[model samples]
Target: MARSSAGPAVAGLTAGALAIVGFLAFQASATAPDHPTQARGDSHSSAPGNGGKKKSPSSTKVPADSGTGRRVVYQLESRRVWLVGADERTIRTYPVAPSSVDPDPGAYAVTSRNMSLVGSDGVQVEHVIVFHQEDGIVFGFSAALDGSLPNPKARKKTGAVRQTRPDGKALWDFALIDTKVVVVR
Candidate 1:
């Protein structure tokens, strides 16, 4: 689903993350919150834990315009990344592109922000997790593992469509805002 450019617009581009919370929840069996298949726009054509070659995003991917404001955080092992978001009791995750490190991953903080990726060992890791919250909410799609209908812009698509990787240069990317707060030890 695509965020309506006609409604109230938010600011800046958010990052695309492979939120684990959501994925685990969706993929979970009857005892868990079955993937709200139609809730948010799933962004892939495969299922989680499948294929094993690519990580699927169980969370939604859209532009954020929630005036609710965002909290900030960072990845544990991979530092130097600004995981911009708010604190929540339940975190919804997606299968984002795994990040590498420079000798060791750098440190990140909500207070400290960095927009550039730190390429290490010939591999550039994730720098900033830009959330396109708008698109996520508007379309009610979580960039799910199979949400590629409404918007043909998602980076995940079929070879028939000849989908190219969207660098997301635009200032809008959806994301999972609310989640269980992890107290890094």
Candidate 2:
């Protein structure tokens, strides 16, 4: 009687395959979001995580003249940013720390993005979304790794609009490359 070697080979292959699949599954779960339900834009919905409730009285409204359709509205005067969905509803709006060198009030698109980098101010920042560049100054939005705001007293010409870590994540998720960005006074 000849012993079949194919059985041991097949079992080994199966074990290796299962190990790879288990590892992949673990990796996916580790990076997955805690909340499984993603928010979709609709006329009745009031931003993600709101559960379709109306915006609170304290929440700032998107400017009337911030341009229509999906766009990021940066209010230079108010130092705020509004992420407007295609439905013209404000998905998220939050305050930002303006940079010393402000970009001209105009329309632009997100040119590039970096996950992490050392900011010009010598601070570690993340979620950098570059939109406009003028002269030699690069304008973008980022959040400090330490959750610190930009130093207004710094004399360097940097156009880094700083936001909180959570806000940075939201903006990172909303504004992608080529997304319209409108700057208004």
Candidate 3:
């Protein structure tokens, strides 16, 4: 009787341990950033912005060799944007909250800009920079004046790359009509 009881207890412990391990694995994958957008070995640092707030730092070099002139580089996988100056130097680099709908990796030009307006998603936005459009959905960069980064609605089609208010201001000042915007994987 003792031997039979010990066998069942051992089996139970093994099953419990397996379950725990499986749960942990699931959590790890879920927390990991979507693999398609993982940074490609680029070094990043955290630096303070003009407002004394910590800003996401990016490497001085562009994420990819998309072109040779001044442009805005948006790394889809890293979810970072770099404002490259005329001399091929990075003017500023910061993090952005990208939409589920990603623009293809290529070069685009800024078609328009708005100082303030209501986004298609109905959010009050400022410094809207229009870069591309697909089907009927327009894609651009904008920031909420209130400094909020709300989650996109599951059923809404949105392609707004969101930044902090200060970052938005910087982008607005930098990206002008016909400014080259490079989208990179």
TM-score for every candidate vs. truth?
A: 0.22, 0.70, 0.67
Positional deviation of residue 53's Cα in model 2 after best superposition, in angstroms: 7.8
Ranking by TM-score: 2, 3, 1
Q: For model 3, how does the per-residue alpha-carbon lDDT over 1-185 read when each residue is reduced to its tens digit?
A: 34465888899788767745643453343221212122332123333345644333333347856686889899887677888877876676667777657788889999999999988767789999999998887889998764545355547778888876766888898899999999998
TM for candidate 3 is 0.67
What digit string (tens of lDDT, one per residue) describes model 2 on residues 1-185?
89886998999888767745643453343211211222443212254676766543333567777889999999998787888888886776667887688899999999999999999888899999999998999999998875555656678888999876766888899999999999999
Residues 86-184 of candidate 1 have per-residue lDDT tens digits of 432112222222222111122221221123343211212222232222222211111222211122243532111100012111111322333211212
- lDDT agreement with native, every candidate: 0.24, 0.77, 0.72
User: Which ten residues in a row are the worst by lDDT in model 1?
Assistant: 161-170
Native RMSD of candidate 2 (Å): 14.4
Ranking by lDDT: 2, 3, 1
List candidate 1 segments past 4 Å from native: 1-91, 95-109, 129-181
Candidate with top TM-score is 2
Residue 141 in model 2: lDDT: 97
User: Between the candidate structures 1 and 3, which one is better when assessed by TM-score?
Assistant: 3
- Give the Å error, residue 54, model 1: 26
Each candidate structure's count of clashing pairs: 55, 0, 1
Candidate 2: Cα lDDT at 13: 81
Off by over 4 Å in 2: 1-59
TM-score of the candidate numbered 2?
Answer: 0.70
Shift in Å, residue 114, candidate 2: 0.2
